[model samples]
Target chain A: MFRILKKSLKTGVATGRHPQATQSSEPLTPEAHKKASAFNRSLAIREVDTGSCNACEVEMNALTNPVYDAERFGIHIAASPRHADALVVTGPVTVNMARALKDVYKQTPDPKLVIALGDCAIDCGAFKGSYAVTGPVDRHIPVDVRIPGCPPRPADILKALTDIQERP
Target chain B: MAETKSCDTELKTAFPSIVQRDTTQREFSHFFVAKDLLPTIARHLHTQPGLHGRLALLWAVDNRPARNTYELHYLFTLEPSHRWVLLSTELAKDDRVFPSITPHIHAAQWYEREIRDMFGLIPQGHPDLRRLVRHEHWPQGAHPLKKDFPWDRALGRQQGEHRFHRIEGEGVFEVPVGPIHAGIIEPGHFRFSVAGEPIMQLELHHFWTHRGVEKLFEQQPLAAAVPLAERVSGDTTFGHSLAYCQAVESLRHLDVPRRGRYLRSLFLELERLHNHLGDVGAICNDTAYALPHAHCSRMKEQIMQLNDRLTGSRFLRGLNRVGGVALDLTAAQLAEIAAEIDRMEQDFSELESIIAHNASLIDRLEATGVLTERTAWDHAVVGVVGRASGLDQDLRRDRPFAAYDELSVKVVHYRYGDVRARMRVRMDEIHESMRLIREIRLRIPQGPVAVESSPRAQAGEWALSAVEGWRGEILYMVMAGDNETIQRCKVRDPSFVNWPAIQWAVIGNIIPDFPLINKSFNLSYAGNDL
Candidate 1:
């Protein structure tokens, strides 16, 4: 127990001041960034994997780790869609999961934001032309932001979440 | 050479008139069996003491325009010798009905269902012929894997209710969980028939994320299919891609450089290390032990960052190509990796000891979800889950591939067949993988990382490649088309075989313990569903 505490202390604060750091830098859209930063202090997110390779899910999970520490930004992954302020979805929206994705979006309260993470969710990525894919997340639900990469880095995911908060 | 000849002679003598043609490949023996004698031969091979055969995979291909028959392939691994024998039979396209091997070999159940769903091939005596990959809403007789079905054709969604088996008892209640889970995990429906807390039956409905991976492979060039293979299961990215690359390389008879082989082996071990570490921690998390989980997650993140440094992707994606790997590690990077592994080993040992000494954690893990040897063997579960159940099958050691043949791999096994045994197997494997990575780094061969070769289209040839992925044996059977394109690529992720074993594992266990047991196995939903 002593060793764990010692190690924890030695590791120091692993959390980064991502939002504040981004705000200090020259933003491409300063007005939009200012609006998003002023609106909310904390955001509750519900992660929904409509259809993903799981690589995206891994990066998202890493956001909660001590290194990224998304909780430091008042970003908590909620247990249910009903309790969420935003829905972070991944995958290309597979055929079987299309209805479930819509249901999750509908279940979330009004004034909820839907953020699409990963290339699959953004534009169907590598799984575009296959029969099982029902196009990207935007085909089913309105997406506020689309984070693109085969799987965007954890830092990128955090930035996207923060950027989404800036949206009017 | 003598053993191969003798085996050929033995097969020829046994079958004589039944065996149409026999061709020996790099890894397996392929025999074209007479169509009518498939069931008899399959049954004989499985039950015979000399053969000690276990069905590894069963799949079918549509050879239309080129041939008027649907070619069915049955791959069986002969025990004791650990040699693979590929048996194939051609069913007339007009009359696409073949005797099901599921009646005798229990593992053929899902394969038969899949064959029926994919190619419209009727497995004559399959006991449960329900849809495997295609959901209940799929239009009848609309088999997607057939050559006639266009790869990009989108069909309208049809509505139909799937009938699940219900247990009839005084107080039996059914609890259906997911297609959408509560946590940040993939989708798969689990229906538990329970009386109070104890589970009477467990039925799984997966394939929610099946993106027609095999069909997608058909549309891609042989070289371009590696990315598709990598995404088959996100965690087993390297394993699946390596297997796919090996299959393509073997089919074209392209030789990979010695250094490339060593690198492939190193990356595979690294992949195993990170996945096993995460699994060990996740299993603990299920039991309400947060400390170990947090520490393990930290360790896993470090490994992920290391992977990002080594390769471009955190999951080690885009490293595998057709003939060999796309990336090569310099001596400095290799040295850094070796040192990092050493530090990881020390940290992991400390974390494991703490978890080991915890009585409450051990209580939740030991004998929580025991998968008996009988059930494991029946399902032919591979990887850590199989090793935990006394199955003692590791493809890396038994059927050596890449640089594994050069290196001595210590296969880890435990006879307990419980959650604790599974965890122990993973822990032991992590140590073994660390040793392997160190050895590979120290003694990596000097050569080009990849061979420069332009492989042309080879018609009427197929090859099977099996890699011991973190989860288990990831098998890829690739058949070449007329223009350097994949005609049919059948992927059998370890989860495909092991998912059924979960039902048996959760037989008498309580509903609350289900998540813990499931985590212990940690079967990939996307892999299985694909």
Candidate 2:
């Protein structure tokens, strides 16, 4: 325990400043700002993997790690969709998962925003023409935001989350 | 090489009628066998003292319009000699039936079920004929892998329900979990039949992430398949791509430059380092030991950032190409990698000491989810999961690939297959991976990183490639088509075999500890589903 504490002190704060504050900031539209107001500065996200390769999920997990520390921004991954303010969906909606994705979206409380978390989720990405895929996340549910990368990096994810909610 | 020659002679003597199919690839020996004799051959290979074969992969290819037959290929990795034997059999297109070898081999159960699902090929007398990859919503009689089926054809959902294997008793009740999990993870359903605290039986229904990857491979050129392969399982991006590249390279007999081989091996080890660090932390996090988890996560991020600096993709995507690696490391870059590894190693030792001193953390890990050696062998489990259960197999040493033959790889194994054993294996392998990275840096030769060659895969030719991913062994079998396209590309992720073994391991263990045990194995659902 002493060794752990010593190591922790030596390492110091690993988390970086929110990338949104440092990176370019586009003016938010009034309509978009109204939607952002619903989150009330604190966002509870319920992540749904419709048919991802799991790279997005890895980055999502990294969001909670010491370096990213997503919780510092008042963002927490909720245990259930019912408690969530936003639905973070990844992957090209596979046929098997389309129904489940819809069910989770329905379970989320009203005024909930759906954010497509990766390239696959946004536009089916590399898996565009496959028969098993039911197109991207928007094909199954109404997507309010799209963070595009093969998997959007943790900093990008953090920036997007920050952009989605109104600044304090 | 001598051992392989003798093994070939032994097989020829055992089955005089067996037709040997010659190939330039030295890693595998192929043969055409009669359909009726396949099970007998499998039994002989599995039990015979001279050839203790492990059933590595079994996949079927549809040959319609061109030929009136479907081809079934069974790949076996032979122990002691470190060679692979591939047995092929042809079934008439009209009569798409073959004897199921699962009764004799046990390891061929999922493979047979998968073949039955994808190709509509019935395995005669198989115990479970239920769909493996095809879920409840998939329309009946629609086999996605058949050559006749269009890649972009649309089909409507049909009404059906998945039947979970039940444990019927007075106190038994089923607790079903996800195709959507609580945590940030992939989608898969788990049905736990529990009596009070202990689990009586566990049935896993995976493949929710099935994007028909194999079918998609046939729709594109050889060059485009690398990106598709990289996403076969997101975490195993390098492993899957490397296996696909190796298979393509073997098809053209293309030799990667010496420096390319060293760089590829180095990246492979780097992949291992990041994943192992994450897993060690994850297992601890599940046990509520947040200190090691936090430190390990920080270390993992460092490696990932290093990967981004070198390859532009944090997951090392686009690093592997058809003939060789796409990126070459400079001396300064090599030195940077070495320095980072040095710091990581020092930090990891301190973290290990912290974990070792925590008796409560060890208490939760020890003997929690035990997978016996017999069960692991029967299931043909690969990689760290198999090593923890005393399988004594590591493909880097058994059948060397890349620069592995040039550099000696120390295989790590443990006897008591439990959570603790799995953790120890990962920790030990972290050290081993770092050592390999150091060795590659020191002795890396000066040469072109890649070769200039037209990757025109010959028609009617196929080759198998395997890589030891951090999770386990990733295998890819590619058959080329007429227009330099893929006819059939079969991907067998370690998760596919290791996933079933988890069911066996979870038996008698309580509900809460499932996450820790599952994290220890950390099988990929997307990899298995694809």
Candidate 3:
């Protein structure tokens, strides 16, 4: 119990793939606490491809497509482990991919949140029984949230991030 | 094409190695003597004039406690008439050395290597039988596919077993990529021999994830193999389930109701439709075509909900039991799926037009990773990979099973044999899936999705089931209800034969388009790595 409590305080927020984007939306000074509260919406997300059906990556590709314009919200794939505040993973956490998934978690810098998209990543959805898999991402890495589906809808993926902060 | 023609029992009779002639689920399979006939059968099958496009999946299956014989099963497909066959011959428990088939069927090259690493079934005559999936230092004598090989072993498998002769040639610096890759893909070790841009040779190292799922299933009950089947590939979930169900039904001698079969087909198409949509977008994203990549992926992502409606799980995991589907969609849900599919089909057409005229994208895909028709055929490839190479071998059309027996689904083939051809196949398949969905939605007969599938089975029972999944012919060969547990089950995926072709395709291609062309065939590393 103490370890969980201690670890919670030690962990930090996940950083986005493009750390530069976070600079633009920096929080106002302490003097502007009320204004910061008024800022209403800023989505901080972590994208993971748990063992991946690769369907997650396929739909993830759409986030940046011209029509959806993912960059408009500064949504980007996490560049490295150190900066991520929320981890969004696609795919089922394949056994071979288990170590990398854990490594990504260890590198997430702290207080990391994970959003597991697609069925495979959730519980080893499809690739569950094969000789090579060990997961649904949560087994190897702690998944805070799960977005089930072969590949969850992009709108839901977007909403998952926003919903996290809105939660009581 | 299958007009009263039957599998010439001659092959089985002549090769006394066929320990069993299995036809549990209407799938005809002959287990070959793997130790002696591996090379002979490979050569014999390839030489048969009528069996030009016949492909075999080379992998050893796990048979628990029946310890005297280690079964190495090879699954073969006869094209046009998708008659499937299995060859299971026993090898002495310790005498793992076997003749290689790689020389005859290029597809068996990697399959043999994977078998060698996992089952300790050494393909003696194989030309380049290097370490395929396991790491260089992975221990000797601890093959995971063996029944006694425990998953909980602390030290795991020991190290420093096999040594390789790394070339010491001039100016040939090797650029190693994965076990981990830059983009979001499976774990594989690709050792590229580069001489400035043009790749001299490519060596693909796999097996970072070897769970011996087939071995684990030998002790599991027939119904328990469902989750194991799903793990064949994270992306290709329903495909594996369809094949597993086929195998189980064959063992039980049960033909699923037409309603259940139609439901199975519905989930299968949904699996295919969403995968292609994601692939089209992913390939574009990999090549910097941001717009189409993202848009297509977004639409593809919505498919999860459709799957959730149809099957409780997004990837349709656990939806397929031994005899039929596990759950049924409500009337409203079915209607919702039909409506969503219509919307998706409309969006895909518009998406297709945008990608078709994108000349910059065309240049990136057209000639990249060109696997000639000859090479593709020589490898005995399947699914979109074979279709893209002018081989119109769709298991659905070639070997009719379940609802496919009634649907006249077109098998789209392209002779170009390039990245574009593969992408074209996926695009056309998505379009075809849209048609299939409309038909299923209109004709879906309401009935029980699943019936009783007793775990118990009679002795001397073996079954083989094959399905044309999104990737290709996904196969399941098993001895079921035997001792109330699977005596042996082999989940042979199309990726076993297709991964090597992707390795061969990258030979003359530039490094940049590697991701684009690699995604063309989109073979599952997890599937193969397993």
Candidate 4:
């Protein structure tokens, strides 16, 4: 235990600042704060991998790492969809996972946000003409935010997510 | 390289009916055996003395319009000699059945089942012929890989039921997990027969992420297929792309520039370092040890940032091309990488000491998931999973591709085959990869990174390429079509072989410990399903 404490002390602080977008000087209107209060204070997210190559999932995982430390912003990944306020979906919707993705979306409580994370999820990027894909995430469900990149960087994901929480 | 001539003479003498085909190179040999004599000859080869033979891959190719037959290719890797032996047989169009080798060789079980599902080919006398890749929505009589079937045809959904083997007795019931898991991981269904706490049996239903990757490869030109290969499994961008490029390069006898080969090795080591670091943290995270997990995650992030700075893609995507690498590193960049590796090694050693001293962490890891060497060999497990179970096989050392022949690779093996053993294997490999990177930076010479050549091969030519990926040995078999198109490209991710071994690994372990055991293996669902 002494070694653990020593190591922790030596490592010091690891949390880094979020993207500049998160630090807006312009304050939100009173109506916007009222509308976003439920999610802006604390957001519970549930990530669903429809049929990703898993690069997006890796970036999503990095959101909670020491550098990003998304939890410090009152955003934590929930264990179940029923407890989540937002659904972060990745990958081109495969034929086998279309139904499951819908069921998970329905299970989330009302006034929820759906994020299509990655170019594959947004437009079926590299897997466009394949027989197995059922197009993008919006083909199956209504998406509110679309973050694009082969896999968007972790900071990009954090900024988009924080932007959504503020604008919701 | 050892000569396989003596073994060839013995094989001809032992089986007079088997006919050996002429080959251009000596590293591998191909043979044509009668359909009925396949199982017998395979069994004989398995038991052949002085040659440790293991069935590596089995796939069927459709040849309908050109020839009224479906050819079956059985690839076997002989240990210690690093020679590959391929046994092939043609099935006439009217008869789509071939003798199954799974009864004698346990490693051929999933391959036979997959052939049955994808090509509509029957493996005669095979046990447990269930749905391997085709999920419930896929209608019956829909074999997508058949040449007659159009690549983009959408089919109507069909209803089907998968029967799971259920155990019945007092205090025994089933626990069914997800195709959508609780965590941010990929999808796969796991059914466990449990009595209160300990698990009696575990069976998995994968292919939930199958995007018809092979069929997609057929639609694209040979040059455009590298992007598809990179996404085969996102985490293995470097490994999959490298394997696909090597397969194309070997088919045309194209050699990567001396500098390109060394850069490939350097990037491959960087990919390994990042993945191993992430996996160590994930395994620790599963065991509720947050300190090591945090530190390892930080180190992994640093490596990924380095990759992004060098290659412009965090996962090292688009770095590999047909003949060589797309990007080259300068002296200052290489020096920066070397210094970064030094700092990471120092920080990692401290984290290792902390993890090694934690009694609770060790208590959760040791003897939790035990996969014996016998079971691992039967399943043909590869990579760290095989090495942990004492298989003592490393494709980098045995086959030696991508500058591995020039650089000495230290293979790490553990006999205990537990969670701790797997973790130890990853930890040691992390250090080894760092050392390899340092050596590559010092030895890489000045030359062109790629050659300007459009690869050309005979219409029916094919080549098999294997790379020791971070997860395991990734194999790609590319068959060239007319007009430089790909007829068939069979990708064998190590997860396809190692996923089944997880069933054996989790036996007798408690239900709560499943996460730790699964994370220890850390097999890729997208790679396996593809």
Query: Model 2 over residues B1-530: C-alpha lDDT tens digits?
Result: 78888888888899988899887887679989999998888888898988999999999989875787999999998977768999999997598889999988889999999999899999998999889999978998889999888998886898999988877989899999998999999999999999999998999999899899999999888777899999999899999999999999988879999999899899999999999999999999999988889999999999998998888889999989988999888999999999999999999999999999999999999999999999999999999999999999988888789999899999989999999999999999999999999999999999899997675778979888999999889999999998888999999999999999999999999999999999999999999999
* Every model: iRMSD: 1.7, 1.3, 11.6, 1.2
Cα error, candidate 2, residue B243 (Å): 0.7
Which residue segments of model 1 deviate by more than 4 Å? A2-39, A166-168, B1-14
Instruction: Kindly give the stretch of ten consecutive residues in candidate 4 chain A with the minimal lDDT sum.
Output: A17-26
DockQ value of candidate 4: 0.70
Scanning candidate 4 chain B in windows of ten residues, the lowest lDDT window is: B1-10
A87 Cα displacement, candidate 4 (Å) = 0.6
For model 1 chain A, where is the 10-residue window of minimal lDDT? A17-26
Candidates' lDDT values, in order? 0.85, 0.90, 0.67, 0.89
Local accuracy of candidate 2 as per-residue lDDT tens digits, A1-168: 589779988888888822332333344456666776977889999999988999999999999998899898899999999999999999999988989999999999988888888889988988887888996888878877778788878888888788777553
Q: Put down candidate 3 lDDT per residue, A1-168, tens digits, no spaces.
A: 353334234422211221011112222233333222332444334454444534566456545544344555645555554655666776655445566678767876645566667666676654455545566576676656666655565555555544454423
Top candidate on lDDT is 2
- For candidate 2 chain B, which ten residues in a row score worst on lDDT? B452-461
Q: CA lDDT of A15 in candidate 1? A: 59
Better of 1 and 2 by TM-score: 2
Instruction: Name the lDDT value of residue B303 in candidate 4.
Output: 92
DockQ for every model, please: 0.60, 0.77, 0.14, 0.70
Q: By the lDDT metric, which is better: model 1 or model 4?
A: 4
The regions of model 4 sitting more than 4 angstroms off are A17-38, B1-3
lDDT of 3 at B441: 81
After superposition on all C-alphas, the RMSD of every candidate to the true structure, in Å, is 2.7, 1.6, 9.3, 2.5
Candidate 4 per-residue lDDT over residues B413-435, each given as its tens digit: 99999999999999999999999
